[model samples]
Target: MPSSIPRSAAVSSVVAAALAAGLLAGAGTASAADVRIHDIQGTTRTSPLVGQQVTGVTGIVTGVRTYGSRGFWIQDPQGDDDSATSEGLFVFTSSVPTVAVGDAVRVNGTVTEYVPGGLNSGNQSLTQLSRPTITVQSSGNPVPAPVTIDEESVPDAYAPEGAPAAGGSINGLTLDPETYALDYYESLEGTNVRIGTSRVVGATDPYSELWVTVKPWENRSERGGALYGSYTAQNTGRLQIQSLTPIAQQPFPTANVGDVLADGAEGPLDFNQFGGYTLTARKLGTVVDGGLEREVTEPQHKNELAVATYNVENLDPSDPQEKFDALAKAVVENLSAPDIVALEEIQDDNGAKNDGTVGAEQTLKKFTEAIVAAGGPSYAWRSVDPENNKDGGEPGGNIRQVFLFNPQRVDFIDRPGGDATTATGVVEGAYGRAELTHSPGRIDPANTAWENSRKPLAGEFVFRGRTVFVVANHFGSKGGDESLTSHHQPPNRSSEAKRLLQAQAVNAFVKDVLAVQKQADVIVLGDINDFEFSATTEALTDGGALYPAVKSLPVDERYSYVYQGNSQVLDQILTSPGVHHFEYDSVHINAEFADQNSDHDPQVLRFRP
Candidate 1:
């Protein structure tokens, strides 16, 4: 939730007027002239023109300053019919006057694109009048929003008789006015109001002043406000909260009924002490869109074939062919070589050769030869050729994790419909609203069925006496997607978002596989750009159908990658239900191998059959 500028018409006018009154702002930010919002979208009034200077726009104001910021929403005459509504979501300056929900006023500002979907049609990008240029022609009466009255945290004194709200102000909390819009809290701080169920942090009593660190229930639960809110600005040390309820939490299977939770306050570590358990606390930080979370550890079986995954850093693509000379040796010698290993982001023959030179064959040959040179070439490798497209990053026309295995262990099975790029078909079942960059698109070169930066390469392998279905993949990436990256002429930030959807596709595919192979053994390992607790992973794992290997490990060594100030476990070893039946020696993260030169670390899971 971002604290942004107020969207009041009065605020918009005053700020823009103040700036132009003194000096001009940057040319890129401010336009010499403002265009009527009605004119900018010459073709369709509903069409969105992102960040265009707009003026002469008027409508019935629909919303006022609410949580996270001070903002106003205006709806066009057709606000009754969503398809015909206009004046998209916009946030304006603070100096502007307060406009009620029904006020009619002339507005001047910028018209920016909302999200790809209309979910945020209410928040069009904006600029505003520095002076009170736009006049309130008629004072619009207050109109109640079409939904339920929000539960707030306001004190009983200001709150409506019986309801418990979540509005409050704690003095020492120190909210930075400059960073987050100040006006957001001015009205609610120290006031008594009902807030939504999702905003509560740590843990608090239904209506009491107590703060509980851990949530009281195992799964999603709700609590009613016992007494009306009373704490207000007058009670400096006490803050009052309103509407309260706990949402769903996926507990780690290893957790006991009363175990206290430490949602990895330090690092991303998960341990499966009792085979399955889950412990959920309040949200720590929101990585991706959802907040951080943890689940019960998933045990690796000792009597089952082992599988592993790794990024291998840049792997010295400078001479991809020659580079394999020592590359294979490093992998086989120091690494606990599993039955299969999926590698991500390597150039065939080094440098940038999407062509046939220095492909998986050469690189994998290096590993087998290295093992042979070491007197133990016990394993063989099988991989798919790059797609017909000739992409450079991966062997299959993209930079991806290729699978290498011992042919003696498992027999390979053919899946005709499995790898045939069912891009859109694979991810359509994921649950959750697709926003801005993560939404589905029409079929085209860019929006084809496959959600992966490249299509997912699936295959079958047999281990021991049983055949195992395997899908070794590298889903997608976050960096280099914004139009600002150099990999292409223009980076597309939406691609970063699409990576999450790609993860959904991976999740959907796994769910589909699980449905078909209820008792079948499956090994799913890959570098999914999202972390373990993200909604993407939640959707991918689909409520514990496939267990994540990291959850079973101790917290100290769980993370496979570190970024900014947070250490994350984005790469992972996910297990089908069958794989969890055995005891595993360990799941290792060879972070040192890939740290300086690359974005990912190598992960190895060892199980002794």
Candidate 2:
């Protein structure tokens, strides 16, 4: 998760952080005898909770929740001790019912350490507690500002009108990124910040609209590299920038607020050197005919247009007729329902969907009918899959991700680099990454053959004059060493590292495409497979032009898939700088859907110009 980071400090020696429990597997700063729960502190320097404890512990209660048959929530409206890291007596369901966010209460819990799950699992800890629960009593209270936005409204209202702002302190707290291994920043819900726009090496313009970095980049140990001072990532790799939309404030019609990193903008406007077929960041600012704030027009009609991507879990046809039927069903019923749809797992070369038997032969035919039936009447599907489905590059997986666009909205642009001008990078590159790593094991399960799969695909399209850059991804499965079996090794980080390389290639490609085209209109949409805050995505956008569509939406609705009780922002839509031109609205997840279908939900967006 992007929230819980393992490393506590970027200092020269990682020895201390490595010894810390949960935070790392190395050394400790304090002697064992002197270690105490109260010693817990925030991770960052600007934090008030870092080296401090609570005083006058009086606050009100807010809300509580008791899940299934086991867990319960204990919340205090005030008096927060951000460093409460242990499974201390400060929280327990037995006495939680008596408390709420509006009532005042005193809290005493050991600031516990965090234990991470993926990536840097060895360097993180949590501010957890387990007992004595919460206490509360009624008291005077200041009505809190509404934290949620109108779920159905456009995000443009959030554009900053005044000056740039910073995410403010919350409950006197901050988390250190390096040594603490604390997973996240203890930000107050809804706090906003204004951030600078960013760009990548090959992409054009402001590069990215909203940028995410704790500070400018500072190179460290050869193995662990952090981007723009955000967190530790790989070094010497490429870097890209992320954009954020600052919330509007008073006086200034649109005051850019703090950075929770959410910005909303619609689609693209085709205008590139390819004679005009690239995504642009300026789409959002364009005024529409009626003067009526556009919910879909400006930028690109995302709100008015629906774009979907699905794994179709198992849509490959074994024979002919069946293949055609399944494809028709997916298009007319599922995929074609959206303005644009990207699909994965369909056989491109294998003669599967042939005859009435349902093979992979006429895969294209199946989709076209659905598009026509779904009303895209003249819709055309794009295919980049191998000609024979025979093992070419990676052999583990097949079924390349393909695109389907509405000719009315999108006009196919030139390849990443072509004649009039070279598309440069994206042809076979990614931005915002330094170096790459590799898995150590040889006879690993993935070595079993099914692990090697078709990589990813990207394309440029012009929608309503805006250029949209779409990158499609299908990551290596969490097979092999992931859920350990002693006989075999765990999924190799090194192998996944190759995916990182591929991701880097994608980033570099985006940057190169922008080199000749200075407009920041771009969107990288696909199955990232990693969460918004994961190492892979971070590496891809450390300093490039891309925005996560989910962030602009409500946190609860940000997830595309659920795993182990937690939701993951897997499939995503990331945009470039032009994102600031319009207002953004996150599409609600369609959850009623079933799974053999897939473990993820498709996200929709509505951009108001």
Q: Give Cα-based local distance difference scores for all models.
A: 0.39, 0.36
Instruction: For model 2, state the Cα shift of residue 283 in Å.
Output: 58
Reference-based lDDT, residue 516, model 2? 43
* Quality of model 1 by C-alpha lDDT: 0.39
Candidate 2 residue spans exceeding 4 A from truth: 1-306, 319-336, 349-361, 374-376, 387-397, 414-451, 481-496, 581-596, 606-609
**TM-score for all predictions?**
0.44, 0.41
Error of 2 at 121 (Å): 16
lDDT (tens digit, per residue) of candidate 1 on 1-609: 111222344533443453344221222333325443333322221223333455666655544443222345443443332211122233343443476546776776654322111111111112222222355677755432322112222121221111122111111122222222111122221111221222222122221111111212212111110111111211111112211112223221121111222322111001011100011111222111122222212423445565667676545334444445444544554444456766765434443444444355555555566556654446665444444433324443345446666565545543333222223222212232111111111112233334345455555565665555566666556643321101111222444456566656666666665665554455567777666665556666775667777667654455555321123567877777766444332222222221122345556665532
lDDT of 2 by residue, 1-609 (tens): 121112222321232243243222222254323233232222321111222233323333322322211112223322235533311112223332444334455554322222223223211222323232334445444322212111121111211111122221111233322222111112211111122221111111122222112222322211111221211321121211211111122110111111121232212111111111111121122111111110121223444545556554444433355444444454455433555566666554343433322133456566566456645445666645332333223232345666766676657654422211121233322343211111010111122222354445555555665545555556655432221101001112334565465456556655655664545455566667666776667666746656676667544445554332123466777666655543333221222111113445554444421
